[model samples]
Target: MSHDSPLQDLDLAAGFLEPPPRRDTYAGWQRWRAGRGHFAPAPRLTLGQWRALSPRERSLYDLHRTATHVNLPLQETPMSLKVSRLVNRRIRNNALKTRPSTRAGVMVTGWGYQGKTETVCEVAAAFEDAWLAMHHHLHPQPTPGTRDVHAPVAYAQTPVTAKPKSTCQAILGFFGAETKRLTLPELIRQLAASLDDHGTKALILDDITRLRMHRADDQDTLDLIRAFMSMNVTLILVGVDILGSGLLRQGHFDEHTRQWVLPPSQHARVHGLEATQTERRFDLVELDRFRYTTPGQITAFHDHLAGLEANLRLLKAPPGMLTGGRMPEYLMRRTDGVVGLLERLIEDGCQEAMDSGKETLDEDLLDDVVLSLDDPERDALAGEVPAIPGSSRTRTTAAPRPACARGRGRNTVFDDHGPRGQAHG
Candidate 1:
């Protein structure tokens, strides 16, 4: 299943109770008392009531506003769920490996600010979160050399000039192993041992692009990764396309090499054992980019905007949120629809409004905040890599994507009072 699958399996919302849904009066703001609830004016309060709040109250309210609004792009749940599924299957297979297997590790690559790191981290965190949620005893000792350790997923970054040895050392350090005294070969062996010892299902290696340049050639580095995975620990590599680095270019050596515990995945191109240089050895799944508009509710920036609106207990919310009607189009132009960029721009705008004593986060403040941000020359999704063919294990044919309704090529006039509209304005 794609990201459209329900997140009930994640079970992430346990223990930390949720507050009851606040009233959505849709027309007012109220007194900004800094108690547990009234940090921001109520949404139903009149405009005059909001303006009457003291500047100190507004500043406090803005702080609360920023706190709830700013977040990583976890709301784009498709990639997160897909990655979790792949990693979960790998972890389970490794834990239950009855015989030798050569299951290749997962490699996730994306450009900067594509939410690759954050999304993978969230996936990694889920293992530990799930572990913590299910365990009755806080101090339960984990079995070493298995995939059921206290921390099932480990994450780290490759050094700027990381060779195989350095990469091993960094990973070893994450395992809480002493790295200063080990030899290079010893480091690699220890890292493998630690993965089994700590029950780590997968090791997430990020910023590994520099490893290619760290050496005059990347052959040894590729061999190092190959050797590590041969030990049966799944490695989820994250970074840019190494292009011809051979890190993700070569398939399995022979039929014997493919006998490891994993089953073949016909839908994913990465499951092949041996491939030509022209063939991709690793599957490429680009992060879901936010669209200016979408026809359906499955994964869109509109959902993200709706989430932000739900959390603002004490901050002033505008009539139309960041997703309302024309807002996504305008916001996409200002921030290019990157989650991090969008959040920063919104936070800055909220701060500016509170500082300027503006009552609500409106189009005026947003326009001002984006003035300092670089302007978009084209559509936010421009230059995105095309979806790879036969690379999705659970991808299904669906309805064609909807046309964005806010931009050019569509025109209409909305009468002051009704839902009916006139086209070709």
Candidate 2:
């Protein structure tokens, strides 16, 4: 059999010809021949390694690995200098004082959206550890009376019918003695007792208005107030402006309560002046809407903005800069001098920007956030105006015309005196 030329051969062979190598295989062969290093996939990180990463590094890793990078939200939001300093001073003073008294507490009151709740929560968290420490130090042991009651009874050197025992049992615990499960009143009493036992000199009740409102009975609230007052515990009662008005109306509180109404200026003065021989105390530091700012304040705000920007950059954000230099001006106008408003605006603005995948915050975004705020004053204004269309016109008009007289050619209306003569009066 004469085989066809190799180029023209066409055999119907059942066995398949050797398959050509894949492109990757050839590339691998070439790489191997060239003695070039092979590209190995990056090593995977274990959970422990991931956990050990710093926040900044983690943020960068997330950005590099994913198209959508979610920022790690801030835990402790920034607060107004005024609010911060006031809270700090109050907490420090109360913590350091020798006895608990009503005057030692802090009272914060402002309109809604002014960060009243946030302020309270922040203050609580800031001092909670210290409060726990103080609580422990004060109630180290049960009272002698309670201990004596626990002694076993004896009858003629022998147990006789197990001497009918009293039903009441004194409960002892780490905190103190409790006759029964503690209610609010019992808890307050126990806390007071513990403080008294430990020489705690200060007490802080954030939104005392809530307590007042919940305990509507004037006498009951008054009694509680008196208990705090009698203890001479420096008390701080924080609430909205309505709190001041409510306290004024309450029969229990009078000029004495007003004495604790620390003005913003006093707050500023105290913050400005360190403890001097004559002053020797922390004054109320008022955060001024207009004045009372230092270069440090601006620096602090800018630093915070810079940190935020750095986080944004890790997400591969296009070069963006925060122009918060005008933040003070923007805050002043938007908040209308309310410290709480300023803080909320800043916090909300950041959240809004992050939500929208924005790397930079502009004035428009801030204005939108602030202007959308609910205005309580608007509600009050609506209440003052009547709904009738012509009511305002009627109110603007002078007293209705008295009996009018018809003149020869013109109709005339009367003044307060009576009907007035027309053309020939």
Candidate 3:
């Protein structure tokens, strides 16, 4: 192996250094689960060393840097750690129950850019990895004479234009099942059958808040989701502002605990007899952005910045480039302490630093990098964090947004105006 190339063994042209799997399909999920986490960062070189390298090596190093910067490993924050533990434990408990009744599901609710989906998916994928290994790559209890993929975790996204039939089709599609001519009932039946046939125990429905209660179809989809609990799959519903979405309108919110308490379904009224509320429970958890009010929170934020700064590949980068002095406070203002926005700002700053030949991040260099001001979370927090030097708070744009995009939601479950529900830090 030559010592010149940054990535000694892997060839970028041969696709050995390709990006990660899509994670939306079965094959992609399997590939993602099996893939390693590390990506070799481009070797940092002094100006003299850089000048000595041949043009080929320089190009390869640049290519490698591009890949490494964007594909930086997922940062585990306090919110992610908490959610992961809760989700993994619940899924494990649900998978063990042999009962015919509904297994308790979990609903993860938070603001946009809070990384709900990524946290849940990481835990679910890890569960599947351990499950397959334990089962010797076979379905633990296979259906008689039938050959089906043992997908312990079935992941699906709620369609933007959601309905009962469309939602069912999405889940069914995850298992590579056919739904061309199937009716709504047929689709649900097939979905249930597929879950059993494929030995799926956890079904994650991301962007679940898209099922608004105002629409008749969406309401029907909500009911269908409740009905799915009886099918022996632990449901993981991930969405933004789920409490405000009216998905839990059927339940009452308790002020004391700040949680929604569901009263049993009133089935007896339709049956012309007295009945108790359904005992189905969904453990609702929240993942919020970092706050700087408390001393502990401030320490955590500094620690997170330290982690990001440690991974930066800038050759001229000084220690405490992001963590020292007023940088953390400036970043808090720019990003509203949202992990996704913070990561974007840093990544863009890194790119700018490399391109501008600065090779170091500072307040002035990051000023040129603009993040989406349309972010609802950032917009909401703008008033609280006072403007600082080189912060987006101080910078103003004269150009107005177009008419079509004006008054449009920047963060909502029904549309993809910005980044999808993915974790950045």
User: Number of the top candidate by lDDT?
Assistant: 3
lDDT of each: 0.49, 0.37, 0.73
Report the lDDT tens digits of candidate 2 across residue range 1-425. 12332211212221112232221122322222232122121123443544466665444333332221122223232444466567667656654656422343445554434455444434444454455465562433336554221111000110111111111011112223463664544555554455456443344333333332322353244334434434434444443343333443423222543333321222212223212212111222222222215665555545554554544422223333443455544444454434344445555665566556553356666655633434432222211111211112233663777876765653223101211112110
Predicted model with the maximum TM-score:
3
lDDT measured at residue 80 in model 2 versus the true structure, 0 to 100? 48
Ranking by lDDT: 3, 1, 2
- Candidate 3 lDDT, tens digit per residue, 109-201? 876666787789889988988888898998998999888889999888888778878888888877778999888767877887898889989
Q: Once all C-alphas are superposed, what RMSD does model 3 give against the true structure?
A: 5.9
Q: Per-candidate TM vs. native?
A: 0.61, 0.40, 0.84
Backbone Cα, N, C clashes tallied per candidate: 11, 31, 3
Candidate 3 global TM-score: 0.84
> What lDDT score is found at residue 256 in candidate 3?
72
Weakest 10 consecutive residues of candidate 3 by summed lDDT: 380-389
Task: Report how far residue 351 has shifted in candidate 1, in Å.
Answer: 1.8
In the order shown, the candidates' Cα RMSDs to the true structure are 16.3, 25.5, 5.9
Residue 141 in model 1: lDDT? 49
